[model samples]
Target: MGVAAAQVVDPGSFKVHHVMFTELRKLVDRIIQIFPKIEAARPRCSSGIKALCSLNSAIDKAKLLLQYCSESSKLYLAITTDAIVSRCHKSKSLLEQGLCQIQSMVPVMLAVEISQIVDDLRAAKFIPDEFDEEAGKVVRELLQRGASASDSMEYAEIKALQTAASRLHITSLTAILIEKRSIKRLLEKVSDSDQQKKKILRYLLYLLRKYANQIIEEQTDDTTDRNEGAFGSNDPNTNFMHAHAFNVESGLENKGYDSHSDKLSIATLPEEFRCPISSRLMYDPVIIASGQTFERIWIQKWLDDGNDTCPKTGMKLAHLSLTQNATMKDMISKWCKKYGITIQDPSMQPDVPHLLETSSISIASFGSYINDLRLPLDISNISLGSLDASYTSDGSRNKNGDGLNLAPEQNSDDLRRDHSSGNASKLDLESLSSLAELDWESQYKMVEDMKNHLESDDLACFSMSSENFIEPLIKFLSTAHDLHDIRALKAGFQLLSTFLNQYRSGIRCLNEDTYSLLSLFLDSEVTKEILDIMEVLSCHRSCRSKIAASGAIISLLNILHSNIIDSRERAIKILRNLSLSTDVCSDLVCLECIPKFVPFLQDTTLARHCIVVLRNLCCNEEARASIAQTPGCIGSVAILLEIGSHEDQEHALDILLSLCSQCVEYCQLVMDESDIFAALFDVSVNGSEKGKASALELLRLLRVTNHDDRQQECFESSNVAPEDANNHAKEKKSHKALFGVKFPIFSKKKK
Candidate 1:
């Protein structure tokens, strides 16, 4: 009979209760037959439905049957379910049974289509309506029965629900507890079990966080509506002070009560997904907002382009991307959905309840982010929001509009280039001897020898086929002690310059760090000869060598600009010579050094050299825009046109033509000045071929000048505009304008 009954019911289509009832009916008859004396001794045999006791007693009876059933039988398991339910109904334990039933049903439904069936059962007429008025009440009351029993009960409940949830493969349930107030209270009651509490807390917190923004937004809207009618017109700010005077009245009068099932829904999820960390729901979701993930290279690029969160996680990072694990993404999604919130993906794809579009900052393409801060530096473990001052490679640390940290680290090479007063001056006789650990006499001797050879023209240049002589001179300088003696330092500088002149490979061999150091020495060395030596070194075989040398000169200029020098006039002369060198001129233009030297241009001795660099930069297509931004660049061009010898006027005109062709904004800067047009016409009519060429170039630039090109040019220039022209220009008409600046004097800002 048992075999036939099992075969007759299709396990796939049959309800668990229907199957249980059928098996129990057959099992009860068998029990009666097998122990007829036992049945007669107790009471008259009744129908299987009437044979069950209280829920606890029925469970005890099921355990008794389990002991006798020796072998696994569908009938035995089925009988246990029937007995438990019947006894639960009989003993007034229906509420607890419903709670247990829902707990089991929800997780299983995640994998199967049991939600409909579970809902029907939930609504079915029971012995009493309010018997299960509260979801966690039964478990809470059962706690007073015994401490261990309560603990065991909660543990088993969490385990059973979690096991079912895993089978259902519904990860979202883990965070629902926080949304249901009753379930939250139930969790609070079981706070002694830290692990269980954490599981509940993690899922609940997840739900709360997901819905937090939406709730706030809704509340804000409601507030605005309430104040609108009272204010006459709907200016929100007008009622702001009085708005808080009114409060939201709480009760069932105006809102639907959070249902018991809703509270249970929250309780049920954490028990479903075994927390990956503890094989239980997470106790505390790791708050990873402050570490290396916050300071990702790719993330920072986004922030610089106006981004405010992780591209993948939608957590606010602002121009900085934090590196995080892929698992976190899945977890966050589940949490968000449970709370009916939308979290945008890094790709800006919508994924959630409201289906709201992400902000522009969040949806920016990877290319755009990278383009914002184009210069590469080592910036690991530094978040845009919580960045450390020491972590940046660029000298200045500033926040972008998105509130992301955008600071570049100071490279060792940069330190060498900007020879500012305080630190360099301190590196004198005592410090040098200590830092290098060599006597001053030996260093002086090497300098003397190098000087004599250079003066007599006896130093042999290294052939292209052999090792570079410039490299050895650099190494010697690194260890040389004569660096302390001003005279010795000058001679060493002279020797280094001579090597630069003799060997083409030397410039390429020197790393950025060495270049910076050389620049620093030039800026700080207390002698004209050393300054002269730097001028010679700044010259190279071709424009490329000169370009590399320009980087070094800029670094030196940056350092020297900060400190007052006794021989500022001589130093200006050397800078002017270096800027005029065609080889390095274009590099200076691209690095934006010309603009930075604008203020110095008015320094009669320095203005001419600054003009030469700008002229060369304007001539080169790659650097024209940078030169155009120079504070006095436009005025300089005008002055060059209005007053100069024929050759000088031609040179100025040549630069003007280059600037107009390559940089529209620069043309606009020139056109904006009233005197500039007249000067261009004057140069065009009265000057040489070069002067006319320049005037024509200016006209072409003005014609091409427009909003579109200006936006594209500045936006595409770099993540960091390393140099600013107004910062280095003459101040007579200096000013700030949209899209950065018009022109400022170097007096307020320097290299």
Candidate 2:
């Protein structure tokens, strides 16, 4: 037997059930001692073989039960103490009965041994351990309040959670995540037919989520404190809304409800999987006229009750019609099969009328086990028709019968890359690795000294053969927020820019947290250096949002408008990069940046840069309208067609197309500028292939929207060559008309 294997579980790990397990061990050991004598006697009668088989089955069951108790979650064991005690008594009872039956058939010596074992089993009384007695009292209190919709965060409930967490040794995030996964596995083990078991599992899951949420809130607050100090924000209104969005990313170590089991948790199940009326897993599912699904018997009963509202959405039914949802039936069948869940017949009454209120664990033990939720279970309260209108599941008996085949927990620490290897020289590797292990003060001292030597080193003309070596080292910049030394901060920002400039494509582990170090706190000492780094990060299309939120948008705007600045060019480039995200563009528009950006369009060197930024801003509806309304914004963009690069000319044409299409007035605005018509003619005939396509498209948009008479007037007003005008008119004649259709700004909407 695996009796020794069960005993291998750490004793402290199962503090609540220690006493029960100890008695179980004693009983199992006594039976093991008698097994040898029974085997040696080898009684040949049918009765002897039958009695021996019964004893063997009981022993195997006991071993498995012990193993389950040892390996299961401590909190699970603590709450299910009643079921644990009852099962122990039953295991002992069956063993005693088997021994009594075998006594008559066994040989004289073995029969004497069996009678003593039966006597010992009868003398045993299975009860919860001392710790379980306290746990039971807390559980009873929780159950009394379980009918409420809240998390029961009153002093008593919180104290109970805290006490239980301490007992289970689940103090770390990693432990909570592991315990959550364990409970989730147990939830998957439940059969659909076992509603009582499902409730207990659901309640446990709810409690664990509350605990996890509390931990998340605390950690988030700590990080927000550090971030606020680094950014120098004192506004009480400055809430960390981004951190609260952790439900999608930071929620529980990226387990993220990303697992199949999480997706199928009953709380978040596909609505169709549950019958709206009973708020239980649906069987014999049927779709009503409102397209909501329900169990056939419930829908039939609802119809028979003279009610006609869709139970889920509460809309009046188009008609009282029900169609069998074969698709739902098939899906339910596949889900049950995949998870090994058993669906019970909804029509059949459960064998135990009050399944949760077991004989061994009566609700009356808790004075007034009130289940009153003021639930309007019928037509009067449609809101109560929700699944959650019922009380939470708790303390009902769960069995470990078919048993669990739990995989050993995995350690992911080994999966991370070892920096000590790869193509870098050992000296370089040690130097890089040492920086990561240093305190912030020492790291600042080292990075400052290393940056100066790099610029003058013999290796300046050459690059590392492994090109990606800098990516792993980029994580060193994550500590930049903690350093207060100005020169060291400046040196770190310079290296960050250099790494990104040289290894942007190769970099895979860019720390967005490093971007937070870009606050105006260090503006006087390292604004130029940090702005340079932001310029590089912004060049990556995916990194723009983090850059925009890094507390430097104000610094960048100030640099843009400054009378004297050494970093204005880099500031403009960063803004251009951020313009790619429509959200950033809308922020710029709200800041009244179009008027500021309009002047940059006339500076030939900055014209291409300004026009390109405006072009990206044009992607957002508000920004597009703002640019159209800004005086000279359109003309400046049109100037890019003549003075800009081929790429810039294409962007210029795109901006005009956007302005023209947004409203009839902007279309006429483009028409009023015959210089733009001439630029369009020039681009249509001689610009790059894409530029020519855009130029023609903008011309077509102008022609389609202004109608032929208005377009001819704008063309007649232009001072274009006769031949170019004829060429433009001929091109327009051959193009297909798109009169009322609005283009989905380059095939997708941004922002």
The C-alpha lDDT values of all candidates are 0.39, 0.58
Clashes of each: 41, 1
Tens-digit lDDT track for model 1 on 551-658?
555544564465555345445545555555565565555555665666764555555655665665555666666556546566765675666666666666666666
For all predicted structures, in order, the TM-scores are 0.30, 0.35
lDDT score for residue 323 of model 2: 96
Candidate 1 TM-score versus the reference: 0.30
- Best of the candidates, lDDT: 2
CA-RMSD of model 2? 29.6
- lDDT computed for candidate 1: 0.39
Q: How would you encode candidate 2's per-residue C-alpha lDDT over 1-751 as one tens digit per residue?
A: 1111123233333434555565666677677677655644546878777677666556545644564576456666776666677667766766666566666554544554665466456556565645455655565456545544344444555566655654444445566656655555555444465445455555655555545545434445543465477445533113222222332133223331223334346434566687766665776899899998888867776675567887668889989988999999999988777766666564543222222222211111111111111111122211222223222222131211222111222233311211211112233323344666677676665665445434322122123322333533445554454544566666677765554554333334455545665654325667777777677677766777777676667677777776644576677878888888877887787777788888888776666777778888887888888887889888788888888889889888888888887787788677666466667878999999999999988878876665654456466749787787778666543211222233322222336
Cα RMSD of all models vs. native, in order, equals 36.8, 29.6
